[model samples]
Target: MNSPVVSKNAEGAYSVKAPLRGIRKSCKYIFSNIYLYVDKNPVYQPLQLWSDEQVLQHQAFEKEQGFELTEFKNFEDIKEMSCDFKEYGICEVTDGSLPDMTYHVSTKEHTLTFDVKEK
Candidate 1:
């Protein structure tokens, strides 16, 4: 899996290019939420969950419209930051009776700390 690229444009808005090809293979997990840590503190926000089908459809749309970039136009003066993609779904081995499980596809190490650059 490729690490998500995070950068700040001239306007001070942040953008992230998170590749979903690896997560697409399973077709089981859905995008739950994004974890953003600024200056080592978790930034809380209400992020909606994207269903599995929705994710697949979005991926296809991105393929046609060029690279998919999720932009954050509300943050500035960030000294340090990191991000992680969280997903939730049922296990493949389950017999449709198990509970949903959550997993993290980190961009960096276990801490999900990635290098942020200014443009």
Candidate 2:
């Protein structure tokens, strides 16, 4: 396990800030591969259960970025899964064209965020 970069504010609120360093090839890697720890339960994969259209859009975006998006062949596969984020708390995603980016997560106890940068 890796130690996450975390800190507390003057208000006693906690936050986790991780630096993501690498060139992620697809949307799956960007959304699913990254590790998200909530209350130390375990590393969470946010994009494991995405909508069919969401997956298609991701593939299109990846295609535009010169990546061979070859994961799901149809919408049925994507729609079959349900994305339930209740366990992770409130979440917000600032979709970026590039894989290297940042994330800001806000929970009742703390705010978690990560920065993904080019390696």
Candidate 3:
């Protein structure tokens, strides 16, 4: 059995080094968030993980689907409505206490969070 090796560095800092010899199993998670915009031009704010081109593409797709992107009064209003775009990453609405509505999604690429202060 190999034991942990301890050594002192030039800075007089002692450290114990653990051996990493076994096969390590790990998990990686990717998350994304959708923010419901409550302004005059209400929109479920696009995610940061999406590129500008992707956003434009999604907008085009939305138009093609005849999905009327309407403004919502609050989080509940958004929750009550249905989303037409799911191919572009918009998912079900989640419950939150923030000023605006918030939605979350998880994928293999990255994680996401929505901020109310962001206009």
Candidate 4:
């Protein structure tokens, strides 16, 4: 059997040192309030990870007819989406608190926060 070895420094103190950072395996996470749009402007706030699963479901919906999700930085890029919903929407069935409303998209490349401008 191999035995453990102890070493002392110049001060004659022996100790064991542990790693500072890596992998983040045992990290703790706390929830933050996720606000989609605020100030009634064309800008969208940053996305929090708490709702990441919901974002995935949205991508699946777009894939039903064989159209896979394409990541875009702006709301205008979505073929079916128009207007500054990221800021304000003046369309039917569009509301401030729609469960499916997203100014955020989570993708393999990155997560984007939107900033909208008045037209």
* Candidate 3 least-lDDT 10 residues: 29-38
The regions of model 2 sitting more than 4 angstroms off are 22-32, 40-119
Which model scores highest in TM-score?
Answer: 1
lDDT of 3 by residue, 31-108 (tens): 222222322233354322233333455668778999964323322233222233434323333343233332222222
Candidates sorted by lDDT, descending order?
1, 2, 4, 3
**Candidates sorted by TM-score, best first:** 1, 4, 2, 3
lDDT of 1: 0.38
Worst 10 residues of 2 by lDDT: 74-83
Segments in model 4 whose C-alpha atoms lie over 4 Å from true places: 1-25, 28-34, 40-52, 55-100, 107-113
**Candidate 2 structure, TM-score to reference:** 0.25
| Tens-digit per-residue lDDT, 2-74, candidate 1 | 4568888897666676553345566634333444433312322222323344545566787788976333211
TM-scores vs. true structure, each candidate: 0.27, 0.25, 0.22, 0.26
Colliding residue pairs in candidate 3 = 31-110, 31-111, 31-112
RMSD of each: 17.1, 14.4, 18.4, 17.7
Candidate 4, which ten residues in sequence have the lowest lDDT sum? Answer: 91-100
